[model samples]
Target chain A: MSTRTPGTDDGSAPLLTLLPSTPGGAAAPAPERADAARNRRRILDAAARIVAEKGPDAVTMNQVAHASGIGVGTVYRRFGDVSQLLWALLDDRERQFQEAYMSGPPPLGPGAPADERLDAFLDALVDRVAEQRALLLAAHSAAPRARYHSGAYQVMHTHVAMLVSRLRPDADPALLAHLLLAPFSPDLMHHLSVEQALPAERVKAGVRELLALRDRPRPA
Target chain B: MSTRTPGTDDGSAPLLTLLPSTPGGAAAPAPERADAARNRRRILDAAARIVAEKGPDAVTMNQVAHASGIGVGTVYRRFGDVSQLLWALLDDRERQFQEAYMSGPPPLGPGAPADERLDAFLDALVDRVAEQRALLLAAHSAAPRARYHSGAYQVMHTHVAMLVSRLRPDADPALLAHLLLAPFSPDLMHHLSVEQALPAERVKAGVRELLALRDRPRPA
Candidate 1:
């Protein structure tokens, strides 16, 4: 792996930060050191491949070390264990996605109207879950109840609740947010996108339709 | 238990019956043996009270035995295990709910417009799940994936799909059915009803609002 930080790298230690006050919105801190960032990258790349080829349960420190051509000692030092390594991998993508919505651009970010932003967020969510179906589903089923407790879920819930509050100030935004997020559950999405072979676009359209009926009856 | 068969009893074995080709409807066969039904009633009544007072996890043969005033040996002989007893409890309610929708009367049954019936069905579902929230949540978390595979889920899916097809012949009834049912997942309902403390009436209203938007836009 290159010892130099990638040009795109801003060096933010996004993963080390726990429980954001604003969840995904205002969370990234200053970047990690160049060598450390590169080591993390090398290790994650190897682990991702192993997860793809063998599955999350099959990933191990030794396998990732052999694949990355990195020292096994360094791998152990970086991730501490296979489970931490897998979470590191999830966190990497999670931060970027959070960044995209929290501050990246209009519609998905802060510049657009609430309804448009909500639509953009749901659309992006379809793609996000689609990107990591197996890994997320396994994680979710392992502790289905923990979905409500996780920092990631809280962040998403906070973000969604904020949007709903803006969209319908008179509505019970907290409950509405949960209702809206229900269809996005990994198990349900697995049934839709994977088992049913629905195109992501159709799922996105269906979600839009589902949300449209939330606060009002259908228009004639 | 009284050995005399009730006049309504038709001598069919309900417990030994397996998966029906059509899920819930047409699955009852004939009425259960009266003495066996009475025994089941006592066992389940005892189990329900224990579940309500403590929780499904707290249920045991001895507690059910003490509450039902039946022998512990009989509880084990009848239900085999706590888990099995809980399922039998669910199935008892499931059969009655199915009967109401399948052959009972107007709106929820046969004589009303499909849309009206759909509305009534969704409303009743809120009540049905709310009735046994703790028991259902325990059973559901134990096998989250199995929700889609269970005979109960299939029966509900079949019923919903039939209604969707009636309401929108050109739409993908099967997929729409799954999408509509996603929110009713026991975990989500628990989060909404128990954790958030939203009342069953509010949940029922919210579901009606949700289904009202099935394929239509919100009324201005």
Candidate 2:
């Protein structure tokens, strides 16, 4: 197996580093000029609002520029294109989510048993995917294979693997984590939530049921 | 929720019916001329050989035609393009696999317990994916989300769901089947076996370990 971390090898640093806060909630490597940072924040915030209101397909550079009261050229300059802007929006949300899971509180973060934490994380993941379903499905469609190597997926895998290691010391935690996380793929989730019209609550419950399968007796 | 069987609703009848044996091992709806059937078998065999030796990328119309001793124009006339030919190959292999799990004797088919059948199906599935890794990856790249709705996926889902329903009467078998099948997605399997360089036996063992989780006691 490659010693390199899963997502670090992928060329996502440029996009990941665009925001002020890193995914680990570490300090920025270098402080951006206050005004430039403000413009970036404004632009990303505007784009996020547009995505929330009308879905990612409805987002446009002009609309974000107008919404943020920034020039269209500035929006173009900062994010390069609509795709990059949307990715930045995803990165932004991802950073916050990482913070919450890594350190925010009990269960999802710290101060809880590994099993409870695993449950909390999977539940939160369903919500996280739901919150950004449109963007995630778009990103997944754009590069299906990239998900396994992407920064976000790597982090999730590492975290889940850690919990599995603690909970089931005898199992292969890394491989098990990957399998556990498979059910949360954006495409599968989209089929369950949008195409099948399954409620998020039901989906979450189903996740718990899968976890509960651990307790079932082996078939004789 | 959809009253339809998963694979039947997908528009795969034309490609699937191209072969004499239906996925169910039932008689073909219509028979082809003897020479045409012979030609079709020759073409597919030649293509499969090329793919096995040189991978899907090396397959070409002229190459298959030359190898099969069929006219290039006939190859194109029967299968419109390289992409269609690949899909036909996949459908062909899928038909055989479907027969094995659906009707073939013993653990994978009719004679074993539901849990053992599920395990056999998953192990066989891992081999099936590995056998067609390059072709499956190419098809997946062409359309990622389509996997959920594809005829092959639907059939696998239906079969797995049936096993789950038999084993866990209290669980939502349909949803659990989808989740269990999620780990076998082509892209992820490619990542594991090709990129990660994990052996097929190891992957199979990992899958068995995942299923074994059902027998593990719940965490306190």
lDDT of each: 0.73, 0.77
TM-score, each model?
A: 0.81, 0.83
Q: Please tell me what DockQ candidate 2 reaches.
A: 0.34
Per-residue accuracy of model 1 over A148-204 as CA lDDT, tens digit each = 876677778889889878876656667767777888888988988977899999988
For model 2, chain A alone compared with the true chain A gives a TM-score of 0.83
Model 1 lDDT vs. the true structure?
Answer: 0.73
Candidate 2: residue pairs that collide: none
Tens digit per residue, CA lDDT, model 2, B1-220: 2212221222122221222222323334267889988888899999999899977656677778889999988988887766567777887888889989989987999999887898799899999999988877777776777777777888898998898888767778888878888989999999888888988888887776665553334447
- Chain B of candidate 2 achieves a TM-score of 0.82
Q: Where is model 2 more than 4 Å wrong at Cα? A: A1-29, A33-39, A69-77, A212-220, B1-29, B71-73, B212-220
DockQ per candidate = 0.30, 0.34
Q: Report the lDDT of model 1 for residue A63.
A: 67
Tens-digit lDDT string for candidate 1 (B7-31): 1222222321222223243456467
Please tell me how candidate 1 rates in CAPRI terms. acceptable
Alpha carbon deviation, residue B117, candidate 2 (Å):
0.7
Candidate maximizing DockQ: 2
Residue B2, candidate 1: alpha-carbon lDDT? 22
